[model samples]
Target chain A: MADRVRVKSWMPPGHIRTPAYLRGKTGEIERRLPAFPNPELLAYHLPAPDIPLLRVRFTMEEVWGADAERPEDVIEAEIFAHWLEPA
Target chain B: MPHDHAPHPYRPDQDGPLTEAQVTEIAIRELLIEKGITTASEVTAEVEAMDARSPAQGARVIARAWTDADFKARLLADGTAACEELGIEMGTLKLVALENTETTHNVIVCTLCSCYPRNLLGLPPDWYKSRAYRSRTVKEPRAVLREFGTRLPDKMAVRVHDSTADMRYLVIPSRPEGSDTLTEDALAALVTRDGMIGVTQL
Candidate 1:
């Protein structure tokens, strides 16, 4: 089970960890990927997906900052359940 | 009372900026050596191998993904297996590959730290690992893309995907149109390192 969130808008700071670079964007849910447990935890120390997730889509101009001359671009993207607040 | 005896300088609450895990990492490394389970030399060798292999491998994967559609499809389905097929081997890393199509583009960044698909794309470009890139990519994705010379339409949809937890992501860009008749080698040649990151097309 996963939570959902509707990200209204993004304030892409010059730098930070939040996928703000991907904010104000939209894409289709391609497929559910995997998940991760709290990294600080011990016992089960592996890089396997502990939970399920969904990937999305975007264009180069959407995420990478492309110019107009060379257009018609896109990129495959993924977002986890943990990352969403609520839509 | 004599102005509170000369008034203390207004030093903003500077709590000696060492509470983060960086300090803990040093402590852990010292402890590891003290326990004799490992030596600094052993750790350094492994680190060196990882460092040396990262970027070159990334360039190769980016180049390969750019030129191979079947390979790209496999990556979209199962990144880990797809990587192994390429001889890059995702190994213990839970890999995920994303495609930047004519409709969408993708970029990756670790806001907390530089969590990248080193095994596949190799070492991340400095910008991809930067805090600005990470933060802005999600919020002002279009603006960021603009910096990269990528601009989307007002009507065109822009989606931002965040890479978190065990799963990592790779951007598989669409093959450029004029590249239809080119050989795989030639196609690979046109795949810029940035293309793999979804910053630009082939």
Candidate 2:
């Protein structure tokens, strides 16, 4: 089976890489990126640690439900590991 | 046609006092110069180099992919490295080339901010950075493409790549039909910035 993941719905203050629109959505991992420094910490000048990055692909139906323009369409976004959990 | 309109709203940057962001930018640049971290000439040269990059670079890549199947495979596999192989410096920008096929159309947008493939395609266009383009593309992409005069059939699936984080996207638009006999340079000439951005098809 393909790897499935869910984006965390946490709404914390300060610099965030996960967009609000993508929160709580489930998607398949399209590709994995080489680890990158956590921008949330880097933005505040904190010592940052590297974390896994993923390009997740979500269908329009999954994101917008009945309101989707074309339910079969898809949207892909880069989400950090901290913002994702195995689905 | 030159004097069709009477007048328009004045541009703030040209007439009004500098904004806080502008002031901060100037202050940092001045500080860098004072500290000898960089020179004024270096800054000018950097700007010149940036301005030199245009859609032409992207056009060249698309044309090559259309003509060479092996190059297209390499481009799809590793966008940054493949671009470097063509003498295009990708810098630190991690690139991913999204291919448009017969059944799918790929469009790129940054809902958070304008995260573009700048090194390869120069600066993002003004419309690409607009609040409307950023917000609506993901919500009602078909309508957004319609505004750009692109009307895809219902059978074709649209893939909107919201470049929210690290990775940048470049749409490898499907090669137009009936251009097989044309030279690679001629093929490159047919590619346009908007088409590469996926707002319109070539």
Candidate 3:
């Protein structure tokens, strides 16, 4: 089963791990990585809960739209589970 | 058996005044030393250790992997352990080698910061640290790779790995054709920093 997900478009202030451009972009889950402490909370030296990290794969066309040089190309990013929603 | 030498005059302005960041850094270091948290010699030793590392070390590893099949398998299996076999200390950071194949390609970038395998490949290039590269690479990898003069076929899949956490990635570029007869030293010579970073294809 392909776990296709869309990156949530949330802009919170202060340190964040997710990139701004990936907001609302749809991609497939490539792999599941070991859970890591949420960096947003870790930055403040607070105890952070471990979150599932997934390697998401997106076609260049999906990410860059028509501006993509090679539409067939793929880009993989490790995104936290909280930032993902079903596409 | 001593010869008299004239003492040079001290010129305070020979070097420009330190910037705000530099002043803050110096003050912090002084405070740390005054509090006995660390010594100046210890800091100097750490700096020297970092200075001793360079990309030549990574190139040597790649050359060996290209020549030895078992080594290549090990590298692909566990990058950190494979590098340790070559006497490269990875410290606490996990290093993963992304092999480039005919159907797939891999590139690495740190979107949040300039996170790189400095211990293996030395200091990153200036352009890699630029905001343009970091911001644009994720959104437009194919265009960025093209700008780097690495144009792949339209059918090939380009997988971009974002170094967002503790793990670091290194690209094991495809062995150049017609170079089977080259010695390991010669092959290592062909590996470049950008190639390992996946900005350039060998």
- What tens digits encode model 1's per-residue C-alpha lDDT throughout B131-197? 7987666546667877877766565555445564456766666677877677766655555556556
lDDT (CA) per prediction: 0.59, 0.88, 0.83
Instruction: Report the lDDT of model 2 for residue A28.
Output: 98
TM-score of each predicted structure versus truth: 0.62, 0.91, 0.86
Q: lDDT, candidate 2, residue B65?
A: 92
- DockQ, in order, for the candidates? 0.15, 0.88, 0.63
RMSD list, candidates in order = 12.6, 3.7, 7.6
True contacts kept of each: 0.18, 0.91, 0.66
- Give one digit per residue, the lDDT tens place, for model 3 in B108-134: 899889999988887776678899999
Q: Which of 1 and 2 is ahead in TM-score?
A: 2
lDDT of 1 by residue, A6-56 (tens): 323545344322355455555445566655443433234545344345555
lDDT of 2 by residue, B1-94 (tens): 0111246455467467888988998999999999999999999999998988888888889999998999999999999888888999788988
**Alpha carbon deviation, residue A33, candidate 3 (Å):** 2.0
Name the docking class for model 3. Answer: medium
Mark the regions of model 1 whose C-alpha exceeds 4 Å error after superposition: A1-30, A39-87, B1-35, B62-68, B153-156
- Candidate 3 residue pairs in clash (backbone atoms < 3 Å): none
The per-residue C-alpha lDDT of model 2 at residue B72 equals 91
* Model 3: per-residue Cα lDDT at residue A30: 79
Count of steric clashes across candidates, in order: 59, 0, 0
True contacts kept of 3: 0.66
Cα deviation of A28, candidate 1, in Å: 8.1
